[model samples]
Target chain A: MINIKKLALLIVFIWPSVLLAETMEVTLLYVGPTDSQAWAGSQQGLDEANLQGQFLGQNYQIKSVTMKELQDLPASNMTAILVDASKKNVLSLAQDAKYSQVPIFNLTSTDDALRSACVPNLFNILPSDQMDKDAIAQWQAKNPDIAVKAQAWHEDFVKFAASQLNKRFKRNHNVNMTDDAWAGWASVKMISDTVARTESIKSTSLLEHLKNDLSFDGQKGDTATFRETGQLRQIVLLVNDKNEIVAEAPLRGVKNGLDSLGKTTCQ
Target chain B: MKFKSLLLSTLIMASTAAMAEPSHRVFISNEKSDSVSVIDMKTNAVIKTINVGERPRGIGLSPDGDKLYIAVSEENAIAVVDLKTLQLEKKLDAGDDPETFDVAPNGYIYLSNEDDAQASVIDPKSGKVIETIPVGIEPEGVAVSPDGSLVLVTSESTNMVHVIDTAKHKVVKNILVAARPRGLAFNSDGSLAYSTSEVGNEVTVIDTKSLSIIKKASIDLKNSKPMDIKVSPDGKTLYVTTGRGNSVAVLDADTLEMKANVPVGKRVWGLGMSKDGSTLYTADGVSSTVSVVDTKTNKAIKTIEVGQFPWGVAVDD
Candidate 1:
């Protein structure tokens, strides 16, 4: 009848002081080295959340963990894990986080695997490659001249930019296609801004806000956010030989010519 | 009783005379509101609202106090405001995503373009881009040395501090720092420069002459996400705003230690120190308020509500 061992374990792990501490400890898992620009930028965002008291009464702590670290981490103790879209290790990290029931925020380049995998807690800030393609198409519908130019230039630039990006994409099965990769930077900025606005350092709330209300004002001028299903409302831009910009054809949500560009691409 | 009353009246009259001196004007850029709110020094009231570009951020006044420059991130340009008329005089193309800037003593303006990953040097008189010095990734913050010989730029993406020679307009060296370095400020002596790393939640102290990070002081706040950094004129204290924390973290400049965290409005994006260096003004983006802090007491003296999403801030004496 006496359960002294269980009581001692509970006291050590669930003490009120540890639970009600002023600072919330959060560990962010990144797929790449912490020094990389993209990961470094994300780390900065986490630091900003801590500085601003977003995790009030909860000290915000971040540890840049790689794929190897994912295996070693006690998942139940981690607040959230952020995976880079371009990283080859993303799939493993996502799978591990899913098994452990740890929430994952993906800054991925595609949505096929995420949607197909159907992880309830997995969310992405960046739109998929298809969304980028569709965004350009919607934009083309609005500016026919720009669309024509983009179509003409696509043949020239696609070969070079695609080849450069394909090396990494091929290694990550989750990535099926490549749009304007420059959108990656915009996505990072958008997510950081959203995190700053929501002021929710908690992993759960941050994930929810990113999925529901965070609208990405991409470099290509698309104002769209991610859906619960992990699809994004995005505008795609096709780059030409001269590195000039354009929108593609066969728009999704065009009602009239004037409102063509304003159409949302989220599924 | 009559003599005592006369003395009291005389004392009150003297105090009123001293208070009658003109108060300095603090200018705030409301990014979401797309306007700059000018606050009167004495009354702490918004004196005027001037419209700028799409998203007004990184505001600064010329040394002469005759002109004000606002970096419009959305528009990818800078709006020059004539202090006399309080009207936008001209819009200058400043590469891409012009966020922060520093005005040199020689009337040249050095601005960091976040998108272009470069710093554009502008001749204020002509409003022309003299030279664009390519540095590290996402150059967000810039500061010029007191002697105007060297310019320092903080690259958020690359996590490096680029030191540039003013004469040649070229990056001489790159000093690595903590993550997401956004804010840059130089000490009065120009011997040292302070940079705020948003991701690192720390302030990096750099030896200007050596261009090396001497030490890093961790700011003790949850997100201590320091954005805009301003050194007092006396050079005794450093003021940093936690963009997400909605508060200002003060540090002793000499000791390089965190002194206090004074609460401000939501999302304090930009900060400005008064000409006298006694008062600090911060633009609260979300709460739409400018929290005025008395430097000596290190407390929020007044909160002047302004346009929606106030961003950059400047002071005119």
Candidate 2:
């Protein structure tokens, strides 16, 4: 009877920890072509998250759907979306009441007007047109009449494990990891990271967590913070004519360079 | 005249010996270049670059500081280099895809087998694997206790740190941390252990006696994904290398509070401290440079260019 009592006490201590390890299956919805690099990155990120989950009790999976398929889907399971479509389609999807609370990331479009619209749950992963203009304007302010060109990512960027990430993508897909692919990968990274940290999968909590406490390592050699305008503050890579990154802007000397790059607020 | 000539020769020998050698040296494992760049810590100069093996990553030194060990991943062996001659001494079997490793007090090499999801104990003298302990998948970080009674291995994919008892050669406890745990370090007394979660960007401090987590502190810096961590010899401060944050985050060891972020090279991966803990050497993986920081001021005073993709830094003082 004493031995039985000791075994009972052991179960009571071990049971709660086992219950806490219950798997959290986070399902992500990819909105792009099946063959696109953007979708590949999202898929890769889903795999990465699942790999992380295998050890710590979280299961991440991705599903690809068309614009039409997304409109009719219910928001009950709270599937997050990664959009790789035109401005009109992206805005339409963002405006849909069904996905209003859902975390939707705009992976490709760069329209400044879209940021001005300020969809609370819609994350603009890429830099906007106005951000580019401001980056050039800041550059020209210092040096007038200088030609300026910039991009979201450069293939040759070797820092921040970008080269490692690129090599992985290249080995898996047999192509260079494109900028859209980077945004797609970043979108999943941001969401899964929040899920892991917050330990919650609810759409409302995810949205609030992103709005109030949003600092993501988007593999750009710095923390990627989101603006109230729903735009990710990024360092625009200034490229030369040969399509190589020459420098970064907000320039090295710019104070609070990360915050200086893009619009801080809506309207 | 003969006695005077003998005195002159002794003076010349003493000066030449002083100029040829320094009191300390730093070794960096260049992963992509498959080489080890030897640097003179006193002068901050690249003294020699030795081609060790295919994809050398984790670099370490023997307990007595006689032989340098480089984990040549592709070769599935540890390249042993003679400290005096700076030559490849021998290669020891380290299981498959060995990365980060540590030395037990008994002079056994605790190697983390990443691909096989296990940790191997190798006898350095005989170059043989005497024991294998199954751990979590993708084990990357290996740290032995100061007493050599326990060794901990962090599994990157599993998000857990397995604490293995050296005497039993078995896992005694599995401590869960945040996502993608990468590095592990033990304090001087073996009373506490700290682990850095790469994806979660948090450091979990563990009380070694109870194996319970004392606290989990967020690095709290933008773009700071911590890779490797080291505690001061006095155990007052903890230095962590922020992967993309490009800085060495200094934290109060007692409170786990943020103290300073000393900016270093891009993608700083691994770090080491001098014996006295007055200086720190950080390997910036992507920029292919090492940043030497003065601990007194918490500032990087010099940056020395190393081989391509310097992954691990081992300082022998």
Candidate 3:
């Protein structure tokens, strides 16, 4: 004779486990080549998160798919998608995933147009570009001499400093202003550091862990955090045209930090 | 009595089912944590944590694995650890911001200091900086020539691989690579050296004999940001970790074509092959763990949790 009640309870308890045992596949849409230093830094974070074996009991098979292949991928089987910042076409992909109600995570600098135009399904794992701007500004405040010295050598130096300063002042501080590899590498290093601190890999729990626990030793000079509103509070470096780092500034804040550019008109 | 006996046997089997090999010692350099978490590979547990200088990035084991050299960026020094005693034996001052380094065949260490724009040759025995050879701006990645006669340093700002004559301690030639060149690896045969460019998203193959970039293979990782490059023991496949692409791009050494994308952790940076060449280990800097990939399957088998901000990894025989 079968014990129907006990059997039913057992089935209910084991059903989720059975489903979890079936490995979930997540596709990461990278904006740059997997080998790019900045993107590789982010990929390392995602790989470490998957290794924690927390999301689904079985490991999540992370597939690095191209932006072109995103349309061809079967969105139905994907558990989640992480988009690197370098991917210029993230907005379109986020829009496509929004209809499917799939979570789209952005780990690069946030685009305002994408954030406002796209649905709420898009979540940024990194801080906004404004945070980087603020970090540079704050650093400038502390190191006026270095800033002045860099400004004096501005013409001979490379174009990183004047452009960085102009961007922060003009309220158009895009990181693309300079060709300083150190600034770029520094940003990658910050994100990499954040990803490495992740303790768990479960999707739902990992998301929470990233949101609450993840913090980076930003290039700008202070610890950066990815806030709930998808804004990051960190330091931004001010480089001169000579390609020398002149100043470091703090950007966004959770409690005591500066507000987002959208919230303030500091420029 | 029979059921009890069966249960006992099953319990014993279950307990030993996943028993791993005795833990080998693993030293993890935590950049943010500024400490090295020592884990016994046999138990896969952190045995102890040793604090080094500020912002420890690159790490390497001596030829005998008795000493560990830690690159302390902020301090502009390399801290040497006596592995057997697990004690900080000495600190060798390199140039400014020593990021990555490689060991020479003669037991000397070559380090790339980005800020100083030079590669310092250090004699590990004396704990002294033997020579400072100016290479390029933001000199980051370094590898010793298989013959030990030369050392190559990649300058990101200059986009050139400066080949240093080990004996002369001067730049022999500046081989132009693509933009933002970083990681370097010499093939097993020493016939060719592979360099990864972060911005160019390509691997430049340099023929050591000719001292020129003989072939340039594009690593078509969508948003592919190539980091460190390592050649397999057989010297058939070239493994490159893509920073943006979140995967290890395998290249057929002979064909110089894209072979496969072995997905790994986010921002895969430093990479090493096991002594036997059966397994590949990547330091997942962002994930703060090491992803162990089976060379045969070309798939990640397990992720070993290590110290905070795990950037560089080295395997001991």
Candidate 4:
């Protein structure tokens, strides 16, 4: 005979699905042209998330919004928000009373001041300007003999676009994917990972996962996480003119551990 | 009813007889070579190399000791190897990018899906997924309590250990540990668990019932990248393989103090012990060898060369 308590437990677990039917909605707020590279990159993440959702048994629907139209939408309907705008503008949106409860992902702006502002709802998937600069500074301090230089991508590589991100973007859209485009892709990927883990797009659980429980895979060894300061702690890659990774930071003794790059502790 | 009881007793005796037979052998999974190196226990020599599949990371015997389950990371499956013939038996879906797994006493395998950020429970006999419990990011290490009532999965990126209720298939508690928590082992009685965080350069001991970290232990070895940990059958000593430190640091279980660091091969990652608890083995990834350490003398007695990137080790007899 089946145990009564076991039967009761089974019924309780199964009964929830019968009661609630909800779909998570992720909003992508872009200030620029909808057809731009950054928009395309963020969309790539949404597509990847959707593909992974098949295995995870979660549903995520994306809604793209322009800056002028964001005010018209109800903030309560948004499960999560991806913001691509200037630092000041993104911070304003993060602090906006209507969207204050939503988890906001900053994809474009890399301002150090934005990170210092420490808006609880704001999350930066891209490295802050301070983080990037600190990474290079730490590397230079470690290896003083080696010369470092930066230049725009050569026309050939841009035209050919042999990198995996570039190749995938080119194959999908018939154009090279720039850094801004990759930022959009990465931002969505982070959300997708969170959704896969939580199975909920609600801001509270998603934000908790992002801040504390994320071991997000940005395709670079799966050791990425968000800092308390709202910076995504990732290794800074020093790419050569040919797009080869010459060096990576959070270099030995530059900082400790794989979870971050610089100023790891946040308030 | 009498006949059924008689038959059950006969079957139990037969199984016990089979287990009593001496079958001393050590198996090491080589990640880069995509093979398992079989070592002769008495001679401390690798007798044969059986090619399994791509990127074999974690290896262990089933609870009954009849089969070996190897986590092939690249294939996203667990390659089941028959112990008697030491050949490939079957592959079971272990979710995408399976890093390691722990076999439960109830015939379920709790597998860590590294890329998927979840733990998938599969029944080896049925080859069906029972459930997938969402865990922290980059889940790497899994340990099921001996009683089979609890499951612990450590996420390297999230730097947390998720305690799962086996029957409920849900995370009951999330215990924050050191950074980059990689490998874990439960004591014989399941009262405590030891976890290693490579980047944090520390090992945390969690009390099972409380689901809280009671102690954090570290040895004074320079550049210590502690990876896999194992508890002796007596629960007196804790054996930790320090990855880059190239040594095995033996610690006193009661006090959580380091006793000795026995030198092993370069970048040692996996730890295993003999059934009698007399000897220990370390899977050295960088040097591609297995170092046999004598528990009595606390010294590495033999270094048996194995395949490339030797990852995990398991001994069965």
Candidate 5:
């Protein structure tokens, strides 16, 4: 009798989520090579997103597309697109009027000009060149004698569960997670996270929420959010040649918050 | 001579009373460093450091305050530490990947097994697993109700708080919360419970009796991804550690309104409070420091550097 009662409770608990699940058909378009680092990261993100989506009563599908096939994409039906293309292609894709409504996540490009473009539809996951330069400058300003450079992602970054992410990526793809991969993963994860939390699948609403409401924990110890420039304000790792993450941009003692790393106000 | 003797007697009595005062100490678990730093609360200084074990995260004191339970995650065990001697007593099996946990009034160590998606209730006296209750996936936070009737585990991936019936050892209800709810704290009377959501960027207030959400408030500060939560002893105020906000937020308990965000070290996560509820000790993970916040002033009074990646803090008064 006790087992029956417990079983009833379990059914009651599991039934509603399964029954009421909206079955939101969200397609996450990836405009990149399947063998690339960014695609591997994005693939892992999709897998994790599906896991999270199951609980949220949503389903996410990834469609690998090319530059030529961009026009063939179900622009109206798709929820979002993540790009791992060149700076020119990214800008052109964002500027294209056909997919203007679809939110585009630039997964690989780090051109400062892209951020300066301030395309409303485009959200750059990779920090701009200026953001990296500024981060390194901040660290260099403190230690004038030591020369440092900026990095987007490092496999050795143990904080904020980066090690777990790296391990999972390596296990899934048989390769170390790179900067592009982190960006790709960040894009999918951010979209899935926003959709799950806000329970909104509409492109415009997701874009608005992505711009204003969402705060992503990009496995970077702190809050990584989108700025007015449509670029993610994230910590840039000061990685040296031995591929060791020596320090972070917005270097602890010198600069203030994450905003110190990137352009906050649009010109 | 009589007057001088009387004066000496009074001095001795005062000294004895001072010594009798509850020895105020704060023990912080440094996960990456594999040690616990003991701080003398009166002076707020690191008086001693005990090498507990690898990946020590969750920490709590026994009901009698005689022992310390540290969740050594990598080893999948709880390190029993004799507080008096500041030494590790033994490691008790706590199931798989115990990250955070809470101590019940009944002196049972309730832990969250993240990897297994379960909460294991261990009897500290005998060092035995009394009951293992199933819960949601990636259960990160374990919070026991003030009355010890419920053991709540917040699962990160599942985004639900599974409330375990202490008496029957059954999962009574599953309460849905925001994304990545990592920490939880109940009011002084257990009438209400507060939880912090890391990715959702909100603090949810739940009616403990109803097992329903009362309110959800967005953290006001920029990059405010709240991690751990603590309610003042009086139950009128809440101290929430904002993860990426890089500060501690003070909120009105009833209104769930953000009152203040006090600046602290980078990536502050675990929180412990003094017996008087006048001070809060925050374990800053990134900077590897503890910020001692005076609740009255809503400010960080001192910063004490600890071992690498300080995770959880347990205070004994």
Candidate 6:
């Protein structure tokens, strides 16, 4: 004695909800506490992309996982992963056989060694240490008067950068920008830019676009493109705690197209 | 000795008076110094630095060559400099954040306000705003046609060129271009306009009549960031300043072909041509100098050091 009218209404209400809930999952691997400043920036970028509906005809389901959670998951389904882990974890995860086919955006690490590691699937969103060093060198060459010495302690600079981010971060959670935070924000933006260009949800298509035809507007008033070494070539700005631009690297004086600041040729 | 002094005085007076139309003075706006550098063509020297105000950019002269209008960006006003006296005559209240402007043939000045996202049409004589036409975001470059019927404003963020009807002060058409279109130039006939895309590393030519992009040509130099563009008086050649490449790219205007890439000073941004159109002057911001390029030989003849960060240049002709 099935009630036909009641069953039909239940089917009509439940089926669209199931279809609507279907979304493209973007996994974020957090090595440390999610509340940290570095992870906060990346989260902000993901939220922005979701609000903007950057992906074509699809909704983004952001799934943030801890290192333990990531390791426990079945690795075969990994499509795209954003790595907000320590340099060591980033290196190990990149080489891990489980996520070999997955495209990973390295958000927190700037170690030059990561670039030399020929992981075809890994892309560095932030400028590498060598790239930043070269930029400083170029700036020093142009402006010999500015004594740009490499110091071990610049906690104040990080605080200032974080404050700058805090002003822009509109959500209920506010965090200062650390190296990881800046990298996270930049990495999400780089992916969003590539996705916007490709207009495809398939991971292979996105990876192809990132490797071959990706030029991201890093929101630094300039466009940054990937080098052969998987490093992002961009204009690095040196600023003080007051958020004033002290100097910009790849300064106007660096001759022969070196002002773009990175590896010129692609690998 | 007395006769020699008398002859010297006579020579000076005669030279000053004879320097009438097609004058050999090049004026450059220095952003950091808040002044204008006046270069003497004969001596190839900066003879004067006139204090204008904060962030003076986009220098252009009236058709009569008696007045020079400078976009003082910080003050949100246009400073009119009297060329004869070499002094600031008055300030006209333009829109907010005026980055660049051009003088129409009908004597009206079209200015692009970067933050305001609109262009102010100001009558230079009366110092009154004719109208403010809303345009795209972050308008950086402004160009008026030779016939003065229309003006083009390039918005960097929007990546579109707003073709404005000068008579009605309305946007006639919106032609999309490459990323970060900074500066533009028009041919002698007002039939074609060439715009430089800073990030795209390309130049787009717009057919004025059709309001369509005729063609786009990529800059061949490695890591080229083409910023400012200028066409020759005869419209035979196009000169584009590659910002990061530190060179001026020469192109065939008609064929849209790359002819030469002349190396100049570091970080060349603005360009000015001599009155005779035989020399090209580059306002090199990073080098703090202006490189003079001989058009015939396509070589840098001289580099005259100027104020800090010279942003724009104009010739008195």
Highest TM-score: which candidate? 5
True contacts kept of each: 0.00, 0.04, 0.00, 0.00, 0.12, 0.08
Candidate 2, superposed: residue stretches over 4 Å from native: A1-21, A136-148, B1-57, B72-77, B92-100, B106-141, B147-183, B196-204, B209-213, B216-228, B239-251, B257-271, B274-317
User: Local error of candidate 4 at A80, Å?
Assistant: 14
TM-score of model 6 (first chain only): 0.75
lDDT of 4 at A213: 74
User: What is the fnat score of candidate 4?
Assistant: 0.00
Q: After superposition, how far is residue A67 of candidate 2 from its true place, in Å?
A: 3.6
Q: State the lDDT of candidate 6 residue by residue for A146-176, as single tens digits.
A: 6563211122342212332344453335444
Q: Distance from true position, residue A45, model 5, in Å?
A: 1.6
Give, for candidate 1 chain B, the lowest lDDT window spanning 10 residues: B15-24
- Which of the numbered candidates is closest to the native, going by highest DockQ? 5
Clashes of 4: 2
Provide chain B TM-scores across all predictions. 0.90, 0.92, 0.89, 0.95, 0.93, 0.92
Which stretches of candidate 3 lie above 4 Å from their native place?
Answer: A1-267, B1-24, B39-45
Clashes of each: 25, 1, 68, 2, 0, 4
Clashing pairs in 5: none
TM-score (0 to 1) for chain A, all models? 0.54, 0.88, 0.50, 0.77, 0.89, 0.75
Model 4 agreement with the true structure over A82-201: per-residue lDDT tens digits: 777888888888888888777887877778877887888888776666667766676678777665432112112321112334545566777776656767777777677676556676
- Model 2 residue B125 distance off true place after TM-score fit, in angstroms: 5.4
Chain B, candidate 2: TM? 0.92
Worst 10 residues of 6 chain A by lDDT: A151-160
Per-residue lDDT over B1-317 for candidate 3, one digit per residue giving the tens place of the 0 to 100 score: 99999999999887665342323566778787787777665555668888887888888887655688899888888988877678888888777779999998788999997765678988888878888887655678999987898889997645578888888988877775765688999987788999998766779989988889888877876758788888988899989988757788889987779878888887777787776677777778778877777878889978777767777766654
Each prediction's TM-score against the native?
0.55, 0.75, 0.53, 0.65, 0.77, 0.67
lDDT of 1 by residue, A1-267 (tens): 258988988898889867666454444555555544445445434433343333233234456665666677665565566666453355555665343355566664464556445555665545454445555666655666653222211222332122222332233323323332233333344444444455444556665666665644332222345555554544334565466543333354565322332223223
